[model samples]
Target chain A: MPPFDLKDRAAIAGAGASAYGRRLMRSAIDLAADAIAAALDDAGLARERLDGMIVTFGSPIGADADTLAQVLNLKLRAYNQTWAHGRFTASAIQWAALMVAGGMADYVACLASVSFSGLRRPMMGGAGNSEGAREAGGSHGEDPVFGMTSPGAGAALVARRYFERFGATSAQLAAIPVAFRKHAALNSAAIMREPFSAGDHQASRFVCEPLHLLDYCLINDGAACVIVTSAERARDLRKPPVHIAGMQPLPAGREEFIWAYPGFGVAQQSVFDYDAGAPPVYKMAGVGPRDIDALFTYDAFSILAWMALERFGFCKPGEAAGFTQDGRIELGGALPMNVNGGLLSEAHIMGWNHQVEIVRQLRGECGPRQVAGAEVIQWANAYGDSLIYHR
Target chain B: MAANQDDYAKPRPAISALNRPYWDALRRRELVLQRCGECGMRWYPAAPLCPRCWSRRIEWTPASGRGRVNSWVVFHQSYFRGFDAEIPYNVAEVELEEGPRLLTNLIGVGAGEIRAGMEVEVVFDDAAADLTLAKFRPRRGAA
Candidate 1:
């Protein structure tokens, strides 16, 4: 199959998520069952029709593909799993799209379920996740030898670098979390519903210096599933098809930091002036950043929202600090983002929640938090993977 | 149970065949990085081949032991029990003269005082008899 043929050929048919909460005290498969069933039901897809699965955060924290199939009575024909990383959410959706388009699977459920409460110590760092003990170092640039542990620690480093490079202040970065919380106040399913002000953000203690506690995301238990099928099959389903207009796969290299943009220089990347120069997702979708009605990113940390904004040509390298201010990214703003409150205020289902929200918003299913007259929505990220979804 | 004063409770680098030499050099109080003999590209956290040239012709030589703090962060929360005593310790990503960045803790400066572009030099910490850590301290006579 030709590559460009994939543009708008595949799409999200349905989306659903389990309850988002701290210490839900449920097994991963139990939570996964709730998400998978809800997603299948949302599309009017029978449980027997769901034949493929791409499970992220699978293994120690979530349900594995094989285990989920066996326990859930699923007869999957194609299944794959990635390590417990939120960044894999985009990769899973992209693969599911290809699988559906290529006749490998008719229906693919891309989802993640995480139970962070069960672990005695949080897996953010020196815990069962083995993040710090990986070969060379952790994906987040964690070098435990120097006590540089946790993914947030890496993001804090990027935040500090960005502040120095752009002359931005921690006070300015507060706009991101503050804005997301406002969106959360409207989202009943969101975990952090209480609204907060910039003063509250400033009053919050620093988990890692330069990053307040609010800048970090909520580590809660939940499962979110988005079902993928060919655009032809999706149109036949219950809901309007959320077409996969464009896809930019995840990238990694010396220049690529998992949490920072290409030239922003977090890990092995060099320092330079970054020009986001028409990211391929926009081109594949035949649209520009300006055409995006609603934008959703993997907001594991508030700094990442800044990174994603600058990464996909939405703003200049250092301009996101200002571009995100004055309710710019909130609902009713010029460009609303994360109307479901995102991982920061919603829940971290390894970014599967963002996918669910994207599907809902594209379908105009998001009631109060919906972007009015929204036809195009995007799942862009700091790590350079993106999917442009249009209804 | 009494805590072993002699035991190193902190997380240590899992010395593998690939990065054993990097740790060995640190144990010797000498800072060394893989300098690709073919492409002359140097890097850290040790790789088997040159990342740039993909050449196996690599040599480990003494580094300048000097760099500037590229970025830094302070950990107010402890992830490792061994580090709980130093709850607010700072970790600085130093950009070396060879153009590779290393994540290390800076001595001779408090967490609040460290700034980006501050000149620093590598200092060895004999963390354990079998393990050594490469730390950095602010360089003298630097503006």
Candidate 2:
């Protein structure tokens, strides 16, 4: 295997997000079209210029590349859709970049859109009938006869183990949402702008034990999209292009459905396996975590932030709680993590919004939420795809 | 509650040819795992080929029915309607002595008392008529 180098072949020219709220009162296709249009507009490119596109497989109403193409009325030379769930966003950007770099397409649009409120079947619906759900319920093999059906429950299990191993408290985990909420206060598009406190987070209801309601990501209905094109072409565009400095997927051979039961030990072991050295993302990107100016880690749940911090080498094992303590992750703090509030307070666009925030921050477009002199940004999704961006 | 009188119309496993033997053994109150005869590798949730060596020489081997809790979660809400009655139940992952991990519930223990590394043994629950499910309980005389 030759060394991978994606230093500056492609860049993100523009990013756009639709209105995020409880119910958008729009079809998934419409929301996707809205985001794509805004992205094209932001890039000063016409719809006809896009020759390739990527959409989320979980799009509400089963919207795929063809559906989005027809909705946007574009004739594309190449297009694809990803079914990897939340992990596909960064990979989608990478694939789109490769297309542009290889001259397969001049410009490509990577999009993720979902309307949970408008869907007949929500994200976790049809639990008992689906094969995956049945497997989760311990109907097969030696699984527990009744396993957790929600991802939040599984995340809670991981959180409990982390707390037990590290002696971390709920009060420490509460800092994540509190800091993001503070950042959300500056984001006009954020869903939860109310000032958050540790007391408030502790007092919030427990969706699953050890994970408070505030610890979970919001389920607001929205979409976000970004336009990727060759760096040379992007330099001539309307906006400052955010270069794709490095991108890589999660390490292979890890277990799936990690949260439903305990063997979470195996997953943690996989992470610890990399403790002796840097993760593949940093190695592939040719930069360390310290090189990042802003961090936009997937925050589907608050515990994930701590996990990413440790897994990505931002801190040592069991030190995330202390590392993030004292507002280190706040807007003006050392790391400036999830400055757009992330999925916890921002709209849940399946981590696509994080990419948008990274682009905006790298462009110095984020007014109040911008990190001072921010030149490099990094975004990692739940499925382990990590990407670093530079101004 | 009577075993046959409970409202147990929950979702049952869509048993297939590959996994039928495992389910059949569970119905008979015996724990079994698939072992690759060629590579001597054992696994759970039966598949046709060995994941390690891709060998077709597989055999059903009786397990020790003993393991330790790797981790667990207490579901505060039910994802399926059939489980609505069993809210706040415990689900655990057990690593058997035979080197396979199975998802099962921890019985005879409070949700708060469950811990990693706790010793547990397999027990069968007839969740529905003719649909026996395997679960785990704390090992007797073991902490």
Q: lDDT score, residue B90, model 1?
A: 92
Candidate 2 regions with alpha-carbon error over 4 angstroms: A1-4, A59-62, A125-145, A254-264, A267-276, B1-7
> Could you give candidate 2's per-residue lDDT for residues A121-157 as a string of tens digits?
5454235223244432322122223645556766776
Question: Lowest lDDT 10-mer window, candidate 2 chain A?
Answer: A135-144
Clashing pairs in 2: A143-B103, A143-B104, A144-B103, A144-B104, A144-B105, A154-A259, A262-B71
Q: Write the per-residue lDDT of candidate 1 for residues A1-391, one digit (tens) a residue.
A: 3544789989888899898899899988899999998999899999899999999888678889899999989999999998778898889989998888777899999999988886676788764448888888988988888888888988999999999999998899999999899999999999999998899999999998989999999988989999999999988899998899999999988898988987787778977888889888888889999899999999999999999999998898899999999999999999998888989998888889988988888788789888898998889999999999999
lDDT of 1 at A363: 80
Question: How well docked is model 1, in DockQ terms?
Answer: 0.79
Best by DockQ: 1
Recovered fraction of real interface contacts per model:
0.78, 0.39
Best by TM-score: 1
